[model samples]
Target: MNAVIRTVRADEWEQVRELRLAALRDPVAHLAFLETVDAALACSDDFWRERAAGAAETGDGQVRQFVAEGPDGRWLGTVTALVERPSAEVRFGESAKVDQTHLVGVYVRPEARGGAVVEALFRAAVDWSWTVEGIRRVRLYVHEENARAAAFYRRFGFAPSGERVPVPGGVGAYEDEYELLPSASRDAVTG
Candidate 1:
């Protein structure tokens, strides 16, 4: 079945929480995410509320979460875009030297893996990222061990910027940064 992609609603914190928990339970939760489910579960409801609100459609455009909903109202996949500014304080890896979007929290249920869901979700995110003023490019970092994700990003027209950051406490593991210039077309992922 096809999935419908859209920005998350502010009041849907429960759904947000559930989706995150599910992602955390995936077999690849370790390689795909930086946080464990235990840490996520420990967060207060207020924390989740703020998290959902901060990325909701009606919130300030700093961060936005895109979710793919199945026909039965279940979330199948999600990806979030965080606005990074040249002078703003850095959140992860190196400081942002340009106005760009940071893609994170990428997740797709195992059952929904080999379909159009990921592309649809990313399309929503990239489209939104370009609409943000000063967004010269969109970028994301993939764990070096996650070849599937790295290949997908390459197919998405995101090429390595030759920058790598060590994975905190990962013992030789690193995150590879990839970027897509805004001037590229939506059909250019295969480039």
Candidate 2:
């Protein structure tokens, strides 16, 4: 697909905002994302500016955002990794209870699926996570009904951690936590 997977720059907040909005509009966004389109659209420019900077390549190393850029320069997909600590307050379902990272905001355009784009994006994300010292593993959460995402995650070597988060106000839907430990080798192995 001739895509470039790289960390986003702080000055590209506009592109970041646009790509996030595009992700929110995808058909499975309800199952894959926590924020609504309207809610994301209502966010001020300053919020996006901060968000972009926080995950930018030049920002602190605690959080990193990677994007798959198409040949024409538009983003095809995006993902972010945030460092976590056992002593820190739980940001998602539960405290990691160990030094680790959580993967979030995963998105890939429908047109870009069934190729190496998603795998490339994940390789970059997981590679960056392992570069951080003392990191035990990388984690992510998928809506139980989002079979496609869960399948991809499993193929990428993440397994269920058995910790679940109830979808707030939802009837029975839940988010299943999955994790991957950085291997001594096999960084590119996705099965």
Per-candidate TM vs. native?
0.96, 0.95
lDDT, candidate 2, 1-191, per-residue tens: 68999999999999999999999999999998889999999999999999999999889888999999999998999999999988877778788788999999999888998888888889898888888888989999999999999998888888899999997666689999999976722543542
Of candidate 1, the 10-residue stretch with the lowest lDDT total is: 182-191
Clashing residue pairs for model 1: none
Clash counts for the predictions, in order: 0, 0
Put down candidate 1 lDDT per residue, 1-191, tens digits, no spaces. Answer: 47789999999899999999999999988888888999999999999999999999888999999999999999999999999998999877887878999999999999999778888888889989999999988989898899999988877778898888988775788998889896664656521
Q: Least accurate stretch of 10 residues (summed lDDT) in model 2?
A: 182-191
Top-TM-score candidate index:
1
lDDT scores of the candidates, listed in order: 0.89, 0.89
Alpha-carbon error at 169 in model 1, in Å?
A: 2.5
Give the CA lDDT, 0 to 100, for residue 58 in model 1: 89
